[model samples]
Target: MIFLAIRYLIERKRQTLLTFLGVFLGTMAYVAVSGFFLGFHVFIVEQLVNNAAQIHIQARKDYLSAHQLDQAFYENSYRHVFWYFPPSGNLGYLEVQDPQSWYERLARDPRVEAYSPLLTTAALFSLSKISVSAVLIGCNPIQQQKVTSIADYVVDGHFRDLAVGGNRVILGDELMKRLGVGINQTVRVSVGTGNASPFKVVGRYYTGNRFADSQAYAAINDVQRLNGTPNQVNEIGVRLKDYRQAAAIATNWSRIAPERTESWDQQNANILSVFRIQDALRFSMIATVVIVAGFGIYNVLNMTVNQKRQDIAILRSMGYDTFDVVMLFFSQGLILGVLGGACGLFAGYFFCRYLQTIPFMPAAPGNPQGYLHISLDSAIYIQAALVALISSSLASILPARAAGRLTPIDIIRAGG
Candidate 1:
């Protein structure tokens, strides 16, 4: 029966080849588009993951509203009012007190790979005549490196320079250029209180984010003193053993601690929203191509069944069962599917490789050459084959059934 199906398809080689080409292009399109989009997404996510801490733990806050927003206010009468305000009379909670306790808890948890206590404060940097207002981050250099890839972006000096004694500071490369200063140069840095204190320039890092690049880093002790709080560290940066669990762990830990916790994903929610839209577009395009390819298979097989009615009837007359007739015609679609799917998978693999070779010229932070990312996920090839074969099989079914129902007697009567 298979031999006969091969012969039938060979007789109409044009139709068979056209239908095969359709399925091949469809399958190849699916793999190529998915690889490009998904690969790009992974690239973006990688940048986000590496440039910043996976989880940021900060002091929590409670807000209060008055009579105009009274619907949100409810209080009992035991020396209590309709609204409760902060006891400290600050805008909100500014600092996380006794961070050593949290550090102890984090140290005990095996999931916590590393954590750094950071004190962030606004400051002014002045060197020669150039002065700029910038945010200053004070952190333990060794621990901060574990949480973020800032150390890797050092273009001119060492990340360890921030650890050096005598109020040394590391600024971004862009900021360094703006300051018109080189290594070991003294710059005046002043926080909210007191007169400007001179700090030595130790290192420079280039992260490609102009704003982040404009910031400076120093030892936690220096920043703490600059912020007028000796032992107050407002932020904690944590790297995890399994970063995939960052968002969930952040939520759980935030509730247990006196701070607000945020994961990289939660911090970049808008970017993920754009990714979701791109995904929808990618799948929709692949689905449309596959459906069109299925139509090509349907047309070819339907035409073949009409042309081979006499053959089908003669086989039925010679005691060939209905199942045999159906299988013979269905085999054509199966053959096209198998061959096209294989070739398409191979073609798509090469296409993705070609894409990777092209230089990506974007000014991404850590990426030097900025090459495009293409995901070589095994599932892409597997799914491409399944989509091609399943659609082709479904297209063949109706025509195969019609061919099977043709009776020899009916054909003879019609001929007569």
Candidate 2:
């Protein structure tokens, strides 16, 4: 019976092709759209993970201006004392003075594997060759490896080269490309409103993310010397020996350094919101595609039933049962959907691969990476196939029921 049904569908070449086309379009739309969003989301999350560790600690909300243990120790006792004194106030906006050895205390805690002090300050970068205003980041290479994966992001040069070059700095790949710079090129970088000094470009790094790849990095002391910001950092990246300890660590930070520490998730609330919005948009788009396919299938099957009334009647007169007649039309729709879905799957995969190859940049609201990486996984393929099949089955329902309802005598007389 299935073979006979297949033969019947093959005989109606035009109808078969049209039905297949409908399913094909639906499947392709689903796969391509979903693949793009999935790749885009993964890219953003991965970049975040690379730049900042899973947990970040920042100054908490405090009525007092200082993040110190207490204002009294520094204000009265250490105010006039220059030697072995705390860092200056204005340049120490984000600095944490561990007079009480807070960092050392946290280091000994089993939950914390590593931590890197982060310095963020906007400074006028007046390189000897070319002067450009850029943000400067300072990090310790040894401790940074424990927190951020900066070492892995170097595309062209080594991180240790910055140390070797002394006054040298690392430039982001895209920024370096914009500056038309090469390794060993000397550029002057100054922090705050200070005059710039020549700093050689010791290395270049690329993280496959435009934002991170646009910033420049120098030693922590260099940033402090230029900006007059001493013994202070904007943020601290904390990597747990085990991620499950993150909540416990966060709780500890809150108890110890209340109003001054935040988890990475808390810090990245805005980006996480963006991901949620994108996910919702993707779902709506997929729903629209499935609905459109279902409607097309419904229309096609209804028209086919009207045109095949005589044939249906003839089959009923020749002893075909209602169940058999229903099965025949169901098989037709199923075949069309499955074949179309197969074609769509191939087309979508190639289309996504092509997207990866083309050097095209999306507009301002989109990422500046200029490439979309699509994931062609079994889950995506299965989703595409199911959309086609369900749409096809739904469309054939009315027609199948109509055929089954026809009595042999009434159908034959009506056909005549």
Candidate 3:
């Protein structure tokens, strides 16, 4: 019966081949589209993790000004030999007194890890004898170095240079490029305190993140001296020994330091929300492609059954059961699915590799990075194949059922 089925399929080779091609192309489209979307989403996640700390803490109840408006706490000493404790502050709550002592006590918890107190004051920079306003960052170099990539972010000179009392500063490559300033060039910073102050440009750095790289870094004490707020810092950047503990640490800090602490998720809520929305959109697109491809499979299988009606009837007369004929046709669908799925896997991998060589693409709105890297996973292939199989089988089902219902007498009458 199998030999007869093969011969029947061979006699109608053009129709059979066309049917297989249709199914194969549809499967390929579905797999390729799904793979691209999945790969794109993984790329965005990786870029986000690389650009910013997995977990960030800031003052709650403060919107855009969480980093600047809150009265954060600070500790005079490092919590541990490795940890440099920063100040803490409240946003909605009345400024708490003795926050320094409060943070110190909290640091004693075993769950606590390395943390740094920080303050951020938005200021503008103007090169001496030049007219350009650039953003200025005033942070504790000692602690900022431990938390942010400012230390490793440096391209020339050291972050420690900003720690000195002499109004020294570090500039980003982009900022310097715009200002036409180089290392050792003098630049004046007008921080809206009273008057513009002068600081010597001593170093340059790049963080790869466009926003971070488009600013200047100054000493925390220099900002303090200008603001006339002694021993006051605005922000604290915390680093956990185990990043996986971020949620736990956030919950602990929220319980202990209520109304003050905010995690990175909360800090960057707008951007994170955008990521989520884009993820949904990508998934929807992939699903739509798969559904359309499933329809193509249905069309192909329907044609196959029509072209082989006589053959199916003859097989039934030769003692081959309806179940056997159904299985035989279903095998064709399975073969097309397997072959197409394999082709799609290779196509997706090479397509991603080709994308990398091109310039960075503009991602969802507010995502400043121009390009992203695609991530490939083994599970994606499995998912692609599974989808292909299900679609193919479903497409073949109606045709198989139609042929199964055929009577030998009806077929013989039609031949007469």
Please provide TM-scores, in order, for all candidate models, with all chains considered together: 0.91, 0.71, 0.73
Q: Where's the lowest-lDDT run of ten residues in candidate 3?
A: 65-74
C-alpha root-mean-square deviation, candidate 2: 8.3
Better lDDT candidate (2, 3): 2
Task: Summarize candidate 3's per-residue lDDT along 215-329 as a digit string, tens digits.
Answer: 7778877866766666665555666566556666676766766445655555556766775675686466446535655565556556767777787777788897888877777
Higher-scoring candidate on lDDT, 1 or 3: 1
Query: Model 1, residue 376: displacement in angstroms?
Result: 1.1
Question: Could you arrange the candidates by lDDT from highest to lowest?
Answer: 1, 2, 3
Model 2 agreement with the true structure over 83-161: per-residue lDDT tens digits: 3453344332345645236677666887778887777777565544665666788877668766877877666667766
Could you tell me the lDDT of residue 111 within candidate 1?
A: 93
Native-to-model Cα distance after best TM-score fit, residue 181 in candidate 3, in Å: 3.0
Q: Highest lDDT among the candidates is held by which one?
A: 1
**Span of 10 residues, lowest total lDDT, candidate 2:** 61-70
**Candidate RMSDs in order:** 3.5, 8.3, 9.9
